[model samples]
Each structure stands twice: as C-alpha cells, then as structure tokens.
Target: EKADGIFILGQNPGTNHPRMLTTLERAKENGAKIVALNPMPESGLMHVVNPNPQEYDNILTYPVKMLLNRGTALNDLWLPVRINGDMPALRGIMKEMLAEEERSPGSVFDREFIERQTVGFEAFVEHLRATDWEDILTGSGLTRDQIRAGAQIAMHCKRIICCWAMGLTQHKNAVATIQEVMNFLLLGGHIGRPGAGPCPVRGHSNVQGDRTMGICEHMSDAFMEKLGREFNFAPPKEHGTDTVETIKHMADGRIRFFLGLGGNFLAAAPDTEYTARALQSCRLTAHVSTKLNRSHLVTGEIALILPCLGRSEIDRQESGEQFVTVEDSMGIINPSRGHLEPASKHLRSEPAIVAGLAKATLANRTTVDWNDLIANYDRIRDHIERVVPGFENFNARVRGEIFYLPNAARDKRQFNNVEGKAKFVISEMDLHKLEPGQYLMMTVRSHDQFNTTIYGLNDRYRGIYNGRRVVFMNPEDVKDAGLEQGQFVDLTSCYREEERVARHFMVAPFNIPRGCTATYFPEANVLVPINSTADRSNTPTSKSVVIRVRPSTRTAEAVNELRRNIDEVRSESASSRSPTRQS
Candidate 1:
C-alpha cells in the first residue's frame, strides 16, 4: 500500500505511459498520498497545492513540502534513494524487515496468507535469513540506518505500493532486483489489497498489452498449442527475439527485415553506435509511427516509414468510428478515441498497418483473414483471448473504463518461481572496479525530454534551465575537483569495452553523493559502454558508470576566440605535446 501511493509523475504519458495519466491524477486527488519519485518535476500535474512547508532537505531530491502538511504526514517522509541503487536499498529493507518479523514470532508477518497465496515462501525465507545487511548496504551504497528507516516506514504503513520504472529494470540484475521488490511487498502481506502492489510503469500506450496480444518473443508451449488450434496452422513454436536479440540478429546480417509497431527503436536501444550500424545493415527497416523521429532517419538501404494514427488523432474506419484499447500501469484496460483530426490523412491505425503488413508479407497464405481482423479490433481481442491465458474475456471485459487482469500478486495467487514459492534474492556486494578520482555516473531523463526527444531545455524539479548537456555532481566533489558551477570538464569512463569509450562531457554542480554523479541519458549515453551491462538481464548498465572529470583546456565559447587568436605561428612550429596525444 505504501508503494502503490507512489505515482511517479512528470513522466511523459505518450512515451512512458499511454493510459496512466488519469489514473495517477485520480489517485492523487482522492487522498491516496502522492510521492512524485523522479529527478525532474515537469509533469503538468505537479502544481502547487501548498507554496511552502520546508526547504529541500536533500540537494538531489525534489522538494516534498508541497505534498507534506499536518494531515499528509507521509509526504514528509518522501526519501530519495540513489538513482540506480533502488534494488539494493529496497532489498536490504526487505531483508531487515524479515529478520525483525522472525525475531518476533507473534509479529504481524502474515504467514497464513503466504501459505495460502504463495508457492515459494520457505526457500525465500531461508534466503532472507541467510542475507547479510553489510552486503546489502555496500551494494546499495546506503547506510544500515537508512535501510532500516525505509523498512520501518513501509512496515508501519497500512497499505504500501512500490512503483518503479526503467531505473529498476534497465540493468543486468533487473529480473532479480524486481523479484526482490516483489519479495519485499509479499513479506508484509501488501499484495491483493487496495492502494498497494508492484507497479511496473510501462513505456508506450500498450507495450504491456502488445505483449499480452502476442507480441512477445517467447511463446510458451501451451500458448503456442492454443494459437495453432485457433489458426489451424503450425505456428512457429521456437522463441523468436527480444529487444536485444532482435538487434543482435540484425547486426549479424541474419535478420533481413525490421518492423516496429510504434517505438523509436534506434533511440530507445542501448549502444547507439552499434544499434545504428545494425539498422544500416538491415535489408528493409520499417517503422509504423505517428511522428517522425531519429529512428526513421537512421534507415537501411531500403527503408519505409509508414505513418500511423496517434492515440489522440481521429480513427475513421469502415465502421465509421474506431477506438483503441490501452492498459494502464495498474492493469486496467481503457478505451482511447482520438477526438482531433489526424496529423496526416494518409496515416492509418496501428492495427490497420499491422494487418496490411501481414497481408502483404503473407500473400500466398490462406489461413487467416487479415482484412477482417483490421475491420474490428474485437477480432484481435478474440484471437488474444484464445492464445494468452488470464485474458479469457478480452473482448467483453475491456469495455469498462478500468478493468484489471489476473496478475499473481494482484490476484493473491501462487508465486511464479521454480520452487512454487516466492524467493528472496540476496545480492552480494561485488565491486567490479573503482579507482581514485573515478565517480559513478548514472544515466537519467531530463524534465524537458520524453525518452529520446528533446522537448525543451528546463528541469523544473532540479531547478535548472536552458541546458540538457549538464552533469549534476555533489558540492563536496565539485570543490575537491577544483571545479566550480558552470565549469566545462571532460567526463571519461574507466572501461575499455567494444562500445565503451570515455569522451568529453559538460559538467554542472548540484547535490549528489560524494562519489556519485548524474547525467541525462541518450545524450550522455556515449560515456557508458555497451559491454557494461547488468547481470543475467543484459540490459545496459546505464545506472553505474565510473567516470573521471578533468578541467577542459577549452570552453564551448572560447573555441571561436582561440581559433581567431591562433595566427599562422603555430602552424609550422610544433612542440612535444603539440598536435597529437594518444593514451
């Protein structure tokens, strides 16, 4: 219930969430207690209900005074943990809480509920009992006191909801980290109740729904069997491709064609240079989008940019009017109809575009009615129901404003682990490498940006304006480096990987940890190497990057001044460190 109260607002609804804006608003207005857990505050919903309560307690944290008052005391406890250390800190808290519950056998640990609803509590308990707080704190980069406090707050709360985004998932240990968060919630019996759950705020309007409606690379045996029975054809039983695998195949000259429903695949992917090269190698790269983006421009030898209808744009089909279905972060399926006219008349709906592509690609096939599926979306839902379990009434139940699905946590069902019970994953403090003058830089989104697009140059939450190329550092680090505010510096990484290279980056001083630094992603992504990814999950390790900052010999403005003053004298006379320096 505590984690559920965290709305994670100011995030771009179009890019990050397709249907979460309204639900977020309703949750806030209904006294659910809002905690805008983000670095930048630019979402329109972050209006002033109260002007002043207290000053910003932490330099890195957004001001919580607006949400905190005499009644909403929970808002005052809005703690800003480290950017990428979310899992370690959260898991550490869970471990501590479980230990406390064990000591007090008569404590409110909800063992009865765990036995009935969960499948793997014994192994999970054992893992928690074996976990050491020192490892958790060191891995998370938090003190023991901090973790205990966070755990105490969660335990005391009647309802708790843990909300997280790419910060938690885009790492090597993303799966394990997420599982730990689930374990934390389950330990306190927070699941299957109002105002609390594990909310994975998805990107795109229906990215989760797309996976629900057969967009997954991994097709389970049972799902495949059902699909085969429905279509009366032997559908490919082999696992297809995930986001990373798809790119790998494209890079290896194996995948001849690329088809994206509505994502800026190039911009959203890790290792920009490699992903771009892969796209260039493809025989046919295609995108069905509502707007033109960098991904469309980075095309193959033969590329196609098929414009599609936006969610807010009108959908005029053979049935006269049309609506699209989108699932919110809370698993609620809602209908979205575009009231405004299309940006272009030639644009087609995503479903229509998919149907057309299928018909064109499989012209010789006579199994499925491609055109009929495009006419009514109910047919698509019907096919989804036949294939994907837990979507039994995909056509009927989706008619409501907000309808939930049968998630194991939400439905109070058994845990989906190997042991038929939830497992408390213990993360050991494994230091890859760290040297003197090396700072851990985390990739973050700016208030002016949405995913990969630069909308403007301002971060209201961070209290910055007119720049997306600035890095945030601790005041102490800035002083120690002999660097002041608005100083230009070279941000270099310590790794030498396939796609990892240290380059110059501008620096701006702000409140962060002594050894920690923060930089905007995609722009600052060049500093992070492709090989420096999280464990098992293979997601880019954007959260943790060791960087060295050096005072730049030249400022961005002094380039022209230096160019003008350097006459013909230095052209012929070169010294020892003159024209070239190689490391």
Candidate 2:
C-alpha cells in the first residue's frame, strides 16, 4: 500500500493537469520515485512551478508570476520510447524482470500472489521466457541496459502506479498494449494495493461518467432491460454507430440527421477532410454548444446552432433553479451549481433542449413526459436512479458535496473475468512498418490549446511561438530528409493506395526518437487515415501514422494562380457594372 514509486507513461501532467503539479511535487518530496516514459520530453514532467505561494513564498503577491519559478523537481527517469513502441518497451522491462526472477527464483516476482490472485501465470511466464530479446530491442528503440535499468526500478519498488493516456491508446495494438501493461502489473502483484494500479487519464472531464450513464453506442442488455423497465418502452437491442461508423454511414448516405449534444466533432475527429465531407453529406445537422467552434462553420445543408447554457451559467427550470451532477475520472459524483448569470437570455439548458426536441419530434406517439422531466431535474435523477446501476438515490446522494459510484475493482480486488482472478493476457508485438523515406508521426495537443481550442499561438512549454502548423522531428531525421529547421514541407500520408497531404508546415528539430516525429492536431489531422483505427476501440490511429515529409513544390504557384483568377473576375464584374459601360 506504500506509494514508493510512480511510473507515468504517455502523459504530460504538467501541461494537461497543471493543478496536479503540486500534488506530484509533494509526492516527490516524500521520497516517491517518479519515472516518465514518453516519445517527447514534456515540460510538466521536467519541472513545474508550484502555483500555491504558501508552499514556497512568505509574502502573497498578485499575478503569481513573482513566485511561479519555485517548485519541486519531477521525473527521476525519463524514457524516450519510440512512437507506438510502448508495448515493446513495457515487454522489454518485463522481460528483464523475468530474467532477474529466473536468476534468483522468487526474488523479483510475487509467486504466492500469482498462485492465489491470478491465473495463467505459467503460460504468461513461458511466453515471456520464449520472447526474443532482439525483437524487443528492435521494437523499442532502447538498448538492453536501458531496459534493464527500468526493470530494476520496477523490481525494487514495493508499490508502483502505471499511468497512461491517449498516446498508448490511439494505436492499432492499443488494447493489446494496455493488456501488456496489465500483465506487467499482475506479474508483480501491483494492482488492488494502495498507490499501485493502472490510471488511465482521460482527456476531458466526465468521460467515464458519460460511458457509465449509457452514452455509448453499445449498451449491455442488462442496462437496456433496466432502461426499458424504468421508461416503459422497448429499447433497441441492435448495436449503434461509433465515431468511425457514424462517419462511414454519413459518407455512404445512410445517415441523414446528425445531432451533436456537445464537443467540436469536426476538429476533434480524424481524417479532417473526409469527416468534413461526411458532415456536409448529411441532410440536417444540429449542434448544442456554449460557444462557436469550427464544427459550426462546416455544416450540412440544413444546420441549426442551438446555443446552450454553460456549466458556469444558471439553469432556471419550471420548478426552480437546478444543478447538474458530473462524475469525475475517479467515479466521484459531485453537484455542479452555476453561480454566474447565463451568457444569453435566449440560451436553454441541454436537458431543456433535449426535452423540447423530443416533444416536437414524438408529438403524441410516446408515453414519456418530456415536459415534466424538464420541469425539475430531480425527476431526471430519479429516472436515472431506476435505470442506471451504481446511481441509486441519485438525487439525494448528489445533494452532498461528493458521492462515489461503486467500483468493484477499485474498492476490492474483484475482477469479474473468466477465471474470477486477474488473467495474464498474451499480446502480440505489432509495431509500425516504415519505409526508408517514411517516419512514424503522432498527433499531440499543443500547450497553448486544450484539445482543438487554440487559446494562443505560442506553445510556451516547448518554446514554440506564434505558430501551430509546425512539425517536431528528430534533428538526425531532419538532416536525413534533406530539410532544415524553419523549412516548409508537405506531410503526406499514404494508406490503402490513397494519399492525403497537409501542405506547407514548418519543420522544427526536436529531441524525439529517430524516425519518429510529432505534430499538433487538428492541424495535422488531414494526414490521419479514416480507416486507420484501433481494433475494438475503433479510435483513430492518431499516434501511429506512416507519413512522408517532402519539401513544398507547386502549392505556392497554385495559390497565386487562384488569387490572379479571382482578381481578373473582380475586374470584369466592376467593368460590367460601370455607369459608362452598357450591355
């Protein structure tokens, strides 16, 4: 239960979770070893200034920059694994650990826990023993000694927490890679203990909650039965469309109506050009949002922008003012009350909009009281309590500051699997196959932006200023590709005999692994193939794209020609409209 070691993989908590820096700082001060594994070095993991002055400063100051530079050191070891090489790197570490265990026999691994709390240990061990070292070294861009060093850390630590994010999940072998991570944990008996488990940091808030509340296209029969019983309606048993499927359906003219409750789907989705075309193919599209985004600009034939109340704005219903409950990553539900006034008087809450739309669409066909549900939020909560598991007494429990939804795996070492114990999954090592002139490119968010919203042009953490259309490549790769820093190049992705090109992006030499490059999206989303997605998850393979970087050729000339044609057309129109000129 002791938190002696913390391993972060593929996440930059410094920029993403800036507030958690202080917690990490304290954890480090308490002698916790922090190891960060990523393809590119993140500033947050390198160093972070404690925002709270009481921890470092004696006097309180406004603006906070005066005391911003003082904070705790982060990341005792930073492993620059190749893009999509997390599976191999982790396997390498486990291999080294197994080697150590073979030498000393029960010194490195918890054999007792393996026998009691786990199944398939013998098979997993045999697989690990049979794995070739050469393949591991090649898949991971690390030497044997580097992998050994990481293995030594895992072997010595009593408690270890493995954290990862989209970097490890947006690949073809994403599920397998994560299962490998779990295999590593289960081997060392790292899960179900204090300060030791898997922590998958989601990009946004309430993502896990959304899934728990049956927001996914795929719902279990049990959930559907409960929903039908509560609502007195027969729910559809067929599977629904996911993001990729939705795009495909739209492109094929199968889907006509597209309604987005929230999120900038166009900017956040992959294959930007294709996704845009799919959206335009729809007969009608509606978006409920607080502010305008890129998705509003790219629309279908009939588009409606339904401005909704923000989380910070008061929601006045027929009963009285109401509050919405949001669940965090940790399954903790909390009531979110808005103290500020609405941005606009015409804006409606999300619930109100949905209810109104349902009433208009259904007319008198359904027995559901849409207007009554909107009258008071408690009615909605009561309905959710009856339908959704772990949400019993949802209205009453949410009145408190926080309530934790029951998590069997988190609360106890309970795993509802085939063997009733944690299973050791065997996964194949499938790395990206790159050609001579191609590099593996991964899309990342800039420090200046949150997801697709750009707050500023500067990526202050990476020292990039005044731009977002810049690719970060290894210096050696830049030289090998015959490109210089600040040079404009076109990034072209070739997949399934189709090539998509993003034009005129500046190349910046960075400390990434050889043959691997990183670029910020949705600027580079055009290079991602719509068909290239993770198996099972169906998430776009944003972290593993084979792309060729070439110098820009005829794009400038094409733009100049188009501008000249526009000017000539304008001149001709003016001449035709002149008073002295007659037709």
Candidate 3:
C-alpha cells in the first residue's frame, strides 16, 4: 500500500479544507508527487504553511515568518482543465496509457489482474483506444504533450490515489466521468491495494453517514425489510422523490407540507427563482434550524420555525444528557459531544423535535415508542444495530476513539457486483457544446462562505475584495468580448426555450480557460434551470451552464447621465471665465 503519486481532481483544498493542506505538504515532503487538475489555480495547493505551532512560531513579523517557515509546495504539476472537461482529460490519459501498453505489452497494464478480478476489460480498453485525439485536445484544453506527461507519472508510480470532489460530479456526465476515473485506476491494478484507489471527497461532514442512516428517498428493499422487521411495522418500499422531483411536485401544487431539517434549501438548490416560487406554492413550510437563513424569510401560506439545538449545544433530555454518533467520510463512527449549554430553554434536539412531530401526527395509529427513544439515545442505537448491517453493538462500539464500519472492497478485496467481481464500465464521451456568444459558466463559493452561509463579501484567496456579485473570466476572453475590467454585465442562461437572467455583476479577469467563466451562487443560481440535471444521478448540472453576458442597462444609463452632468459643469465653467467686453 505504498503511494508515491497523488492526483487531485476538481477540488480546491485551500479554501474547502484548510487543515488538509498540512497533510498534503507532509505527503509532498515524503517524496510523493502531487498533481492538481483544476479549472482555477487554488492557493492551498500552490503553497501551504504548516499550521502546527511547534513547526513554526507565529509571533514573528509577516516577512520574517514567511522566510523562516518557507511552506511546502503542494502541487508539482498543475493542469488547468477546462470546465466540464474532466471526462475528456481522463480519457486522454487512458488513451496514452493504452498506447504505452501496446508498445510494451503487460508493462503499463496488469493483464493477470484484469483477467482474474475484472469483467468487460476488453470493451473498456477498446473504447479508450478508439478515443479521438482532436476531441480530447478541444474538450480538455490541453496539448498532447501535457496529457502524455500525466500518463508518464501514472506509469512510473507503483501506487497512486485519485481524488475528486463536487467539481467533477456536478455535470451532465458526472456518473460517466467518475467511471472513467475508476477505469484509469483499474488499468494498473490500483483497486484493492494499499494507497491505490479512488477517493471521492465528500463536501460536508456526516453526509455519508446520513445516507447510511437511510436519509435518502431511494432506500433498498433489504434495508426497508430490516427496518420493518425491527420496528414491528410495515415500511413503505416505494421510492420517494429526489430534489428535482420534490421541486416539481411543490411547483405543481401537489405537495402541501414542506419540512426541512437543517439546510438553506433556497440558497443551495438550483433555479433559485423557480425554487422560491415552488416553495410559495406549498400550503405550509417549516424548518428546524439553529439560525435564520434565506429559506426562513421566503415562506409559504403558513410558516413555522422550530428552533433546534445546534450540534455544539448540549442536548439534555428527561434521562439527563446525550450525545449523537456521526460517521465520517471514511466510515469511522465517532461520538460527538457538546460541552456548551443550550442556547435557549425552548430549543429542542433534532431527535426530540422529530419524535414530537411523529407522536402528534401519528396519534395512536403506530406502536412505535417515540417517548422512550427520546428519553435515551441508547435505545435508538439498539434499534439501529438490529436494523442496519455493519452496525452491530452500535452503542458499545461508538464509545472509544472511533470504530470503522465494515467495507468489503477495502477489507477483503471483494466486489459486490452482479457477477461478484469488479466491472469495467464503458461510457460515451459526452461534452457540453456551447453556442456562439455563450460561455460555459459554473457556480462556486467564495472564500468567506461555507455552503450557503455568507460570512463576508470578500474572497481574499482569489484577490476578490468587497463583492459577491462579480464574475471571474479569462483575461483574453474578456478583452476579445470588448469588455473592460470592473465593467458591469448581465448574465442570461437559455435552457429548454426558457431564459433566466442575473443582472449587474462586475467582471474580474482571472486565469481560467477560454470560453469559461465562474460566478458565486446562490446569486448565480437564478441562471440555473431546474430541469437541467445529470442523466443517471439526477444531480443539478450547476458546474456546466451556458450563459451569455450583455452590458448592463443601468450601468450604461448611469454613465450617460454622468457624462451629461460633466459637460454641463464644463459649459458653466467656460461661461464664468468669459471676459466683460463679450458680456
């Protein structure tokens, strides 16, 4: 399990995970080659200072500290990939690797491993071999030499880790692109090995845990049967609505009640204006939250705000005190305890609120003991242990530092596919084609924001100050469009014969690829259509949007008025300076 090379795809660790920079720095010092493939250059990947105080003191002057603590350069090679070009770039690398395998048979690929543990390898290889170089170059915005350099690194490394995030997953070809990445790793027998695998970094903490705890609408029949057996009641096996379906239902006036646990749905969801209208169409909307957000302000006919205790606040019940178990990205179950007292006496824990709602709604229809579960969290864990697999002795196992959930692929090198082996998937090369005068746009978060929360207006890492209503564009593209720095423009997105506009945003020149632009959302969420989603995943295609920029009408009118006022002042000054003989 020795890893000598690491490839980061579509993630900006600097702003997203500041603490991970130190880990990357250490990896680089240990003779590991780090390659960063992103659309924009990130500060965290460029250079990172060790945050540990023992490594360097923080009391020194800024310049002195910089010299004394010369940080580690995280990225050895940075590939500025075009927006939504992840699939093409991965295909290009795989194509190069296939060529090398052809030249030196069995040197670049694992023939024995493919034959023994994988299926459909021949078809996958054929697809890569037949990939067009012209499409690769155009879609990836990289030359043949660049792709070859990346393949060479992969060929030389005995073990490698491929990491990706939302950047590659928020597109129409999101699922297909990820399969391509896995195919690249499997070409050299990277699966079921130490330090060699695919790592899809989760955007938020406990997201995987939420899915594991049956938070999704599409739960498997096995899980539902287990849950029904454990709870002594028949559970619904029908698939529930996803985000897109929920929005559509809400818009059609079918969904009467809307309940949100802990999210700024209005700001986070795509097609902000449409989502807002849909929410307004609901009969009643309710939210369980710690603080007020934009969703709270935009409500339905009858709205209710249920104040809940924050994760950091003490959750006290009739029994005494309690703690919640949350699973991390790597399947590590850890108990999270809050040291601080509750912010308000009226605030209730999430579980208590849900239990109260269920007890009131169900009345005497169900046999489930909501009161008992709310009194002690151990009872909930016990039920979970009985219902969910790999969670045996949940209460006892979650007490120590951490406990890992069972992962067959990682532990036993066993694939849980239909054929009981890893399957090599073949996907089509689908690239988003843009029309003339339209640029590929994507929504991004500013440095001062986390998800939908806005802490400040400035993004210091990207050199953006005093603004969130600004679009980042390539300098050459900006100049070619006859636009100047700080010029105001209106962005309009056309999808399914419908147009959505976000007005009056200033342009900032950046180092992004040509015909691509980036803007911060939920401001830009207005431009995203609710209908535009990924094929299989049904995820919002927020990362690859086609939008046109036009000069702002208000800015143009203001400029004209200012020029007329300046001329009037000039004429007045000339008249005042005239001689007495002329008068």
Candidate 4:
C-alpha cells in the first residue's frame, strides 16, 4: 500500500490471493501506479472490491459501507507477455532503462547504490548493450512500444515492488528467470527499502513455515550446526531427497516406506501415472490427513489413513488446549488457536503423531525426549528460539499483535556474499519453440479449488461454471486447430518418446496468447513430463509442458460407459422428483 508503483507478474492475486486485492485497491486509491504482466489478463487487477465493511456492522449501516466501497481499478498499465517469455520482457525493460540513463545521465539509474551496495554493474551494462533487441522482441512476443511503456512506468517510480509466483518458476531456467527479476530491482535499488523489494508470493499456506523449521531437502549448514549442538548428535552431511528425487527413489524400490504429512501426492505431483506407480511400489504408505481424498484411493500394499485434527479443530494435548505457531508468507509468526471441538476423540494432532512415530522408530538412539517436546506447544517455540536466529524470546514476543522475522537483505541493506555486495546477473532467454501441432501447456488452479481440494466445479474467475475438465485456449488457436468451442479433446505429452494422455477436455476459448493453453491441475498433471523439470531447483516444470491437442478419441466402450453414467444420474433425478418420493 505504501509503494509508489507495483509490478505484478505471472500471478493472479484476485482468485489465487484475494486478500492482496484490498492492498492493491488501497494502493490504487493512494494514486500508486500498478502494472500487470502475465500471460492471461486477470479480473482482480482490472476490478476489485474490498469485502470488509469498515463501519457497517449492522443491516442499516452495512448498505452505507457497501455503497461507499463499490469497487476500484487496480492497474494503470498491463503487458500481456507470452508463456516462458518473462526473461526477454524483463531484459527488454532493463535495456530500455539503460538507454534512458544514457539519454539523460543521473536522472535514471541509482549510481550511488550501484557503486557502493552492488557490484558487476559495468559488466552488466556491457552485456545489456551487447544484447540484440530482435531476440528480446521476438522471444517476449511483445512490441518495442509495449516494452518501452513498461520501462516508462519503472523510470517514473522511485519506490517500486515486483511480485511474482509459480508463473516465473517451474521452468528449465526458473532460477535464472528469478535472477533476472532481482537484477531488474537492483538497478533501481529497490531492495532494503520500504514498500520496495522482490515479493515471491508463496503457493500454499505455511510452506514458508515448513522451510523455517528445517523441513527442506538440503538444510543450511548453519542450521545443521545449530541443530547438532542442541541435540548432541552430528546431523547428516549428505543432502536428502526432494519430491522428484523421492519419487525416483521409490520407483527404484530403494524407498519402501512412504509417509505424507499433507497434500495429495498423486494428484499434485507431475506425471500422475509415474507417481502412482512409485506410490504402489512402497510397502507401507501412511498419510496424516483430516479428510479422505484421491491419494487415499491410490494406496500402496498396506495403506494407513491416520486421521488428524484440522487447523480449526481444538488440539487438547496432555498439557491442556495447545495453540501451534505458524509462519505466514511475510515471515511473521502467529499462533493458531483452534476454537471448534474435535470431530472424534481418537483423532490426534500432527505433532503428536510425528512424536509417536519418532519414539517408536528411535527408541533410545537419541537423548531428546519426544514426549516432553509434544507435551506443550510452547516448549517447541522455546526450542526453536534457541536454535533459529531472530527468534529470541519467541514465546513472549509471539503473543504480540505483530512480529516480523529478521531479513538481512530487506532489513540492513547488507549483502552477505564473498564480495560483500549484491551482483547483477546475466540470464539467457531460451524460448520453447512449438511444432506444427504442439502448444505450450501450463497447469493452473481454479478459483474453487485449493491445490487438489475442490470445493465446487465452477471457476467464477474465468466464467467457468459447473465443469472443471475444460481447457482455456485462444479463440484464434481453436479455429486454427479446426476445433470449435465446447468440443471435447485429448491432450497428449511426449517426452523421450514416451507419451502420456489426458482424455476428454472441453475447449473453452479464453483471453490467452496464441500457441499456449491453460488447463486445471490434477486433471492435467498427467501431461507434465517427469523428465522435464526446472534446472537448479529440480522442481517439476508444471508450467512449461509441450503437448498436442487432438480430438477426443474415446473408444466405443468408453462412450457406452459415459452414456451409462448419464442415464444413471437422470434416472436417479427422475425417481427423486416422483410424487411418491419420501422425505
């Protein structure tokens, strides 16, 4: 809300993050310029409403507040860049800004900040100058004028914030693309300033918290040293397996026991069939969950569904009703106090379950007492304070209304590097070329769903109602492919000569770029190749899948099966509507 300008890229804060719209709306009202750069035009950026009634608490006053907070326009500029074209677009903007600085020195670039707090400026300028505009223009699928417009916005604003999400990640050069974003911000010295920084909107709640508690494939050496000193045991020097690595290990029969804390492993993971096979290979697969989902259906030889308390359900531990602390996306720790009663007395908390498992597996191998740790939730915070930096007096300070964790780059404007300064990155733009019948397919979550949990079949953001098995494509692309609206089609992805098919996706023409299509995830996760992943992160490239869209080739038996289902539903509906129907 305090920023002079906001650049939102590769994320739809409206449907995915509706809470952010109020801030954007407030920023707009404050006369802040907002720029949206994404493959699809978002409704939230264009139009947003603050649902919170400021003064209207009752029926009479509610109308007054509603009438006052009608709506707000959130975007002053929008650039519709194609998928995987973010690198070129970002580079193009930087190139324009560099030229602007040359045209009128001292008015554009932050020379003092670049000279003192940053390094590699001269090399970065030379690289930018040596770059060809043809590649930037072609790869970005944008015109020079459009690119210059975005540059103009950056040039005018002193304090700017750049925000991005999964759209920038999940590619071959995900890390490089992010570096490009950092480089862009560094030019204007956006970091370590109020209302100015790189905001990476997390995909799920408490994921940042998970990383803070040392739940990562590769733990930092500093964290490992602290944990070792605290526990009186040397932590493993070798790095553990990530999601993709775990899947591969499971498939190789190296990992027999599989346990999932949360999330639908089969549905959310890339290559649905491969992931299912990997899960099936496991001897025992246990999941700590609140409710049943698709993962429960696709179980291993011996599956265990250990039902646990939901976030809202009260956790009555041995130490009385306990409240667990969770870290938000902003790195602020807050207590989660559940008010609702437990659904069942047998249900246990996630911490308790993990504690029990630890006690059983490592009986006397360690000196740590699992029971004592799980007794009171405050004890966990105490331990975290001792080990994790910036968490001193966690139990006392966490009770406050607002608390922000320490960030060196954002707080002190200090860069902890070999050179003791931030360096500008030079990233290459590698655009994915399409074949004759190929389209760049990316999976997206609908408004009605949170990850794999579907609340309804409708996606109100895209005007999709009562159905999820539909693809959002350009109308021109549909016509070019000789396919009409509402036509059923099958999406097939071929990697390393191995093909995977997702059947019967209805075409829904939308405002998307040519040669690019968007499909709802879990339904389209099958098309994401396991072999195709982001470079450094080793994360599955879900946002950059190459696929061929062809007419739905349903067998006669499959057509008969569909007819049977429809007939069964119609008959049930007719029977319920009969006059003799009992209440």
The stretch of ten residues in a row with the least summed lDDT in candidate 4 is 574-583
Give the candidates in order of lDDT, highest first.
4, 3, 2, 1
lDDT (Cα, tens digit) per residue for candidate 4, span 339-361: 77777788888899999998899
Taken over the whole model, the C-alpha lDDT of each candidate is 0.65, 0.83, 0.83, 0.84
Candidate 3 lDDT tens digits, 1-583: 2677889997888776666787777778788888888889988778887756665445554456467867777788888889988788888988998998999999999888788888999988788878889999888988888888888888888788898888888898899889888888888888878877887877566345887889888999899988888877888867889998899999999887899988789989999999999999999999988776779988899999998887777889889899998776667888987777676788888899999999999988889999999999999999999988899988888886589888787777689988877888998887667787889998887766667766666688899875677889999989988999989899999887999998878899999999999999777999988999988899998998889998887997645644564465355445433332010
Model 4 off-target regions past 4 Å?
Answer: 55-70, 555-583
The candidate 1 region of ten consecutive residues with least summed lDDT is 574-583
* Clash tally, candidates in order: 17, 0, 1, 0
Best by lDDT: 4
Q: What TM-score goes with each of the models? A: 0.81, 0.92, 0.92, 0.93
TM-score of 4: 0.93
Candidate 1 residues lying further than 4 Å off, grouped into runs, are 1-74, 78-80, 95-99, 114-134, 417-420, 430-433, 496-504, 553-583
RMSD of each: 9.5, 7.2, 9.8, 4.7
In model 3, which regions exceed 4 Å deviation?
54-69, 556-583
